[model samples]
Target: MNTIKTIYLILCIFAISFLSRFWMSEWKWYAQFLRLKLKSKEEPDVGFDNKRDADPNKILQEADDIYQLISSTKPLFDIPPFERSTSAHNSKYYIMNPTEVHSTGNLLYTYVETYDYQGNRKTTGGDFFRARIYDKKTLTAAVGSITDFNNGSYLVTFPLYWEGTVYISIKLQYSSEMVSLIHRLRDIDNYRMGFRGIFLSKNYKEMTKCHFNLTFTGPLCDLYYHNSGIKWMCEKPKNLSCENLSSLEYYFNEPSLSEAEKKFDDRKNVLKEIRPVGASSVIVKKQGSNINLPKCQSHPLTYTNSTGFVQNHTWISSLCQVKRFRTSERVIQCIKGKKIYLVGDSTIRQWFEYLVKIIPTLSKVNVGRNQWYSEKLAVDLTNNIYLQWRTHGLPWHPGVPLMLPDSPSAVSLINNIYGGKEFITVICLGAHFTRYPLKVYLETLIHVRNAVKRLLGRSPDTTVILKNGNTRTPYKLLLDNDWLTYELNQAFVAAFMGMNVSLVDAWDLTAAYESAELHPSEEVIKNEVDVLFSYICPNID
Candidate 1:
């Protein structure tokens, strides 16, 4: 009887321990699954226009309503998906540097470091580090927010210019002893691996720190750091032939990865991989000199006190011409009495902001605070047209037609607005569809097209431009570090045709910045908007 009792207790303990570990993993997985499901199902909420004399509860109710509005509205823009590589034994780390350029606005710079065992199918351990930035200056506010974190990427608007250099670092800690146990269990397969980090700083100064440490279970094979920013060590400490970083050529033994994979220079898919071109690199291609476009009256664009921007005096089809398009006048126009509406995503906001700065001839114009949801400018011109922007988030299917009054509120809203005047609706939506399957994206477009058809019944002059989705580093989050901007750009342009809508090839214009940083300079913006401008009003000011 005693022996039987002992066996029963032992079995119960083993079962409980086994279930506990599984429960931990399962709980973690369920939490992640719910979060992702919510993220994928994006819907923004509308805002409440609360009255001035509303009581405290009314305000609170309005706040709740606003939350609902934000919840239902679609996100026009989103960060890249932070997905782990499927390889079980490997681990990947992402390096992010937030940048704010005047032309490119604000953006997060991302670089990836991947580590793997000799032969493993799974990537593991790699986790997110939690940290924050503090502003010591006058604002007395926290500069960074954990709420802005979407998956692995975080949000940062342009830090105020006066804030000075921001003191920023990371806080990371290992979770669960199982990872440590796994490391010990796979001792023979482990090998030393190095990662090259890339990031951009607010200051143009090239100096930066590489903070790291290593744990070893075996004999210390080597230890060295070079001025060339390369480090390596061999079995014997006295022997140091690895200092010649320039001569070091990385060759991949496995056929699955490319030659560029060995070296950290795998970021080029559109352009050939070129070594880091310093300040003195010569330009090999000539810009538009032979184009028949009229030359600008203003030679080498002079800065204007009125607009606080450089004015281009010429009209050329090349990148040089477009970046400088804002030089003389805003290239957008509202017909004397009709509403000119710019609808779709935040990328359209760039166009909206550009139009606001350039169009000076309008007599009466009312501007409101900009929201990611939408922006409106009532222009009193020969044609009293309200220049309006209506933003929709992902799953931007304009909704079903003639289905029911409450079925598609978004489409119903557009139909309600389309009562009388011939509205000029310029739409460019599709950037938020990276994670969404292409079939789903196309189906959404079909719904949108049907809505447009119902609203503006085949009016020839009623212009509708469907700009192909803007291009970005698609697999950046996956550490597939191949920046194939041109290839992807070409693919986007070729893909969208015969939809009976005017196609603006914004991606092609953006390809000029292939070798440049992730952000587009003034040149790239001009090129993109020029296509729209040419489609709308081709004549130079």
Candidate 2:
């Protein structure tokens, strides 16, 4: 009896220890989130209405314009799948200029003519195409710029940056009908994810359905953020008041695509992954060494920004000089005395993760047991380097459920910072926005832009970096497709056209290196951070 009792006690202690750790781990990020919010609440949350005065029609119109700018490919909501699917095997492509030897300084273009399974040339443009010119021997690749002429034909342009035999490849990610179906689904419902709001008080505890959009037919407590005017809703509690809302839990909401939409996201289907109809490769020779490129340092990216190509697995930016801080000592020195703030999707979170890893002196606070969860903080006391990152609001489908307050817009993060020369803010958005509709994205953009305006208004010397969207593969769910990412990025570029903040061209950075993963490889992340710091410490080189 004594031995059995001791064993039971031991098991109880072990279980208690395990659960205590788990509970603490789960709650730390939320604790930090609240602390951060409280510290920054001094900035009046005038709410979202003032900044959201953007003409809805104009914003939607601009969204349409971005699609046309990328390719004359609009979603075919009314078209049938049979008429819209492009046949990869039936399609054909050829080099416009198949000369014996291509010059490094010259321009090369290819015309890809997409066809249906029936070998009929497509009349409307909506095919998802990705092009790259790469040399296997040197491991050099440059993403090809594609122009959909609204007809079946697309113009793929490549700059001959190096002297080598480079092969050209094109892939049809989705058919026009499929793309159209995806768009139609976007307008049908705004709910991508769902949440359960847990309201707690002295004697009552309850959980109610909550979501960014209240598509459910029920009485809901429509609540708005007192400061930013951001709105959120939850099913009305049976007896408890909505004011008792204390915590939130999230669940992944399946896209639930219809039969036609299912074909586009399925890899087993022939409608996707069509990579044929193009010349294998061409050779080129360097003309001269007359190009004296400037460093990567720049204020804001421009239309005519010079994008130097990658050579020998390194990004050589012609936009401005780039100083690669490869060593820990170099990174420390460059970022010393700098308080860097990162917010947005997991991409920005990558920087926070990388920084703490590379710099031994930088210690990450135990914000949460789940490393993947957002709301992170790291401090380098000796260097006076403070680093923090948070995930953006709605449409954020983190593997772990986050409290409502933990999931906030980048605007909230931006507003909280006390900007100065010592502070550097890097915002990487649009990854989550890529899959959202135009109107939703435009409203979010207005909020972010206005927050940036406020940040700059107070501290003009603060260095602001807007990390644009990176290229990602269109997998079973094309939610974060390469084309959609680009479309949203262009919108960001247009939204913050003249803003003081520099919109870092992540598209070119990722594409030039052929980094296509939604969460790209760490090497790509490194290059991106290097590019970001190039502005933070332009003289590091």
Candidate 3:
């Protein structure tokens, strides 16, 4: 009888465990369903029904039209007739000398001259130009420095990295827009131009007296600041300095325009190819294979050890001791049983696009009119892995439809997710918010923080990653610029400090490249995604 009792007890224990597991799984699904139902009721339908054009050619044509509009309207100041020069007017524009480059670790020199349609060199210095050196074989680029002499002449310097055929590319900058950027840089209180931090002091006098540091050290003040200025008076208990502050002089800098220009230019500004007048190619000879390239390690942020930045190029992270999944099979294994939710603007959408391209079986779900803000699900049933991309609520760009029902807030979306060790959340914001006040962005971030906190309170093992906004070439029609995004990125970092989250540091990754673009090249995106994968599956090889 005792032996029979023992067998019954064991069976009862197993039954209870199985029932509990089943209940939890059902609860998660039910919770998500309830939230979706509530959100649908809260958001009113806009009564507009439209579907995105599915024809690839039509999409491409529409993209070209947009690019043309952006490029044609980019110039804040009209090009003076005297500054106009045709390709046929060879003497009107020229590279003064043969491009000279060192084998390695040396600055290459390139001089450019601009002339009127009459072929006379213009003496005024307000014209802007950019330069870059591209490896012929790989097409990889290194952005060159252009120092305007203000005498219709400019000097270009390129950093040598490898031995190969190098092609030079250059572009012109609008003078009026450059001046506006300069003025914005000089204003300390401009939210888009200046740095921001969090100060917790209850003492009103000290808070009012804080001042900004003016030196190089001041820029580094993101993590460290002097106590003497009004900027230094924040309380010590939870004070956190901004990360990745930009110097006032950084506003004037312009990097090369590469594939990003061609990719982002929705309308072809000029029917003809826009090529630099005096194009030249030079061969870079390899110095030594052992030449030491810089390596970046993670640096801890103030207030939390949960996140950090790599002092080296973010690309290096993929090649270093960091583990990477080189095959689809490996990637499947790494992400098995995990669900990833990517939230933000089109930039984050790029990441989703890349994953779809790489994973063959990951198919898109067609939701008709709900496609814009609808969740795109890519499922690998064999691995039980699911990936989703959703647009954040509000401040939608004009490019997106205006009549669609509002999507759930990022915070709300995050809170509703069944977060745990198996869940990953990635978020990026700023490009759309550039036109709004800084306070608006801050309020949005605060809401996100609270949501993140709630998520952690429920599932401390959930991994959250934030991507910083990238820099972009200056365009007057588009109010977004690298400097403005820099401030926004800083605020993003400050808002999440001390939280249990990691940062992808897209700002530094984009800045390190020769091309500083809002949407960086595929190589850069690949690296960014790799860095994210490193966090998601840190032990994967």
Query: Model 3: per-residue lDDT, tens digit, 353-465?
Result: 78878888777676434454456667777777788887675545433332223344576677679889999888887786665444456556655655666676678788888
Error of 3 at 356 (Å): 2.1
* Rank by TM-score (best first): 2, 3, 1
Candidate 1 residue spans exceeding 4 A from truth: 1-338, 360-370, 382-385, 395-422, 473-476, 479-496, 515-519, 539-541
Task: Report the Cα lDDT for residue 454, model 2.
Answer: 77
- Candidate 1 residues 84-109, lDDT tens each? 22112232222232222312112222
Best by lDDT: 2
Give per-model TM-scores.
Answer: 0.37, 0.81, 0.48
TM-score of 2: 0.81
- Which candidate do you rate higher for lDDT, 1 or 3? 3
Winner by TM-score between candidate 3 and candidate 2: 2
RMSD of each: 27.8, 18.1, 25.8
List the candidate 3 regions with Cα displacement exceeding 4 Å: 1-314, 318-326, 368-371, 398-400, 403-406, 473-478, 512-521
Model 3 residue 59 distance off true place after TM-score fit, in angstroms: 42
- Whichever of 2 and 3 has more lDDT, that candidate is 2
